[model samples]
Target: MKKHCMGRVVAASAVLVSSGAIAFVPASAASATEADCDGIGVIGVFKAVESGASFNYNGRRVELQNESALDRYSRAEIKSGRKAGDRLWVDRSFHAFPDFKGIVSDQSAKSDGWKMCGPYTGSRTQSVFNANYAARACAEIDGTTLCGKWYVD
Candidate 1:
């Protein structure tokens, strides 16, 4: 159910930025549709402006901006379709969604999708999927060339 959410997209996209620090977000019991991203646990995130809104599938929004983390990690967001329409996530492949590079978490991982995003993290207390893919982030932060270790699933 998409409203005239372009401005909302831009507004949301505008806030897409990650702080160069770690904040362990606990995983949720089930998948969620809220912007809070209850189920999907985001390991790490950075200024992946190069990804170019990987969350947007065929122009529809998939992930919601992480408001608390300055939109760093585009939290996996599920929107209720008309009577729950079919999701295009079936054909799991890198080029499945040419314009998008979705995180493809948990179930989505079973099927091919875009590379993951975050830091190489771990959790002994519970199950956490950590991808070793390195995502180098080199962005100008406060007039300084900020570059360091960022991860991609």
Candidate 2:
């Protein structure tokens, strides 16, 4: 099953490569962030710490970039994968992420674009930023980062 799944990914990659949709790079090779976010590149998938939500930082760790850039890439990720159903859909259970902005380190200010629902006020449309780091009473007030608790299924 794993091999079959990987085969699909490889075939998809080949099609993308041939059509100039994305460049072809060996899995062992290093590519730029644009390539990674461009469908032709590999995205690093991360599971939500709490709800088992699955997401990708567009190949960069969420812990690394600024909010603006993160938003840009995340938007791309969401739009790029509709056919594959690779979106960060919030479950009806939790409903939404908390409002009221909190300050995040300037280091974490950028995001890969699509945060779960909570951090951006229940609108998956909002971008995640360092200013909205996990501390500010989002869901329960004084809780941990929303990303740590929310699922992206």
Candidate 3:
């Protein structure tokens, strides 16, 4: 008597049957979708002008002008029985000026969407200077997260 294990491979997506039971393996599992953010409904939208950077949140707005540096903007959605949203923004500056400011917002409902913004500045001197800026957007729904980022130099 000879015993053999018979199997076949399909085009990535395949079904295996054994003992009157079947299981399926999908072709692609890692894909970017809206549910990447873990149900967090927060987004960050930022812009940079000649002087500084500006950010907005759910119709609420904050602007940093002249001699300021925007650091990071982040958002997260909380999964609860009712659902909620959270947002955070941070900035920094120097030279006898206190340029660090932090902003945060919370929403009562999970289905609600939120936004945030901030600025980014590089080093400078009397002779040579470097100016840079950036922006980002993020959102989450159904336990999925999505994000987009941009920069200027």
Candidate 4:
């Protein structure tokens, strides 16, 4: 009977967290200050590939550079893959990331012409300097748009 009671106590101790994670909170835990984190973070390295053109099949990355009050640049790097050669391309932006759902970065911010992804290179960059903006990376190929998550850079 004691063992069963202990098991029940232990089972009641844990809590579930968002992002499909499990956490254990002590029954004695006090209500502390509200958490400041919004739970958004780096989208990390990702891949964008299709039949006609495969760019960054191995890995692609979104980078935050020159962080400042007025000169930040969001870069997309096609780490490796078959050359995009104009058929495949990478795009990135600052301000809003893909996870925001209906919220998308300003269209004008995608200033780079489609030619941004050149046959000889695997990188392109765009700039939008803002204090509260985040980073988003995407690729266009074979009539499909693949986007990774976004994060506050």
The number of the candidate with the highest lDDT is 4
lDDT of 3 by residue, 23-86 (tens): 2334212223233222132223422322212333233233332222333322211112212333
lDDT against true structure, model 2: 0.22
Task: Estimate the TM-score for candidate 4.
Answer: 0.33
Task: Give candidates' CA RMSD values in order.
Answer: 16.9, 18.4, 21.6, 20.2
* Top candidate by TM-score: 4
Worst 10 residues of 2 by lDDT: 1-10
Residue-by-residue lDDT tens digits, candidate 4, 59-114 = 44322232333333333444444345412222223233324322223232322211
lDDT of each: 0.24, 0.22, 0.23, 0.30
Q: For model 2, what is the alpha-carbon lDDT of residue 5?
A: 18
lDDT of prediction 4:
0.30
Name every residue pair that clashes in candidate 1: 17-71, 17-72, 44-118, 116-153
**Superior by TM-score: candidate 3 or candidate 4:** 4
* Residue 146 CA displacement from its true place in model 3, Å: 0.7
Where does model 4 exceed 4 Å of error? 1-71, 85-122
Residue 64's lDDT in candidate 2: 20
Q: Rank the candidates by TM-score, best first.
A: 4, 1, 3, 2
Kindly state the number of residue pairs that clash in model 4: 0
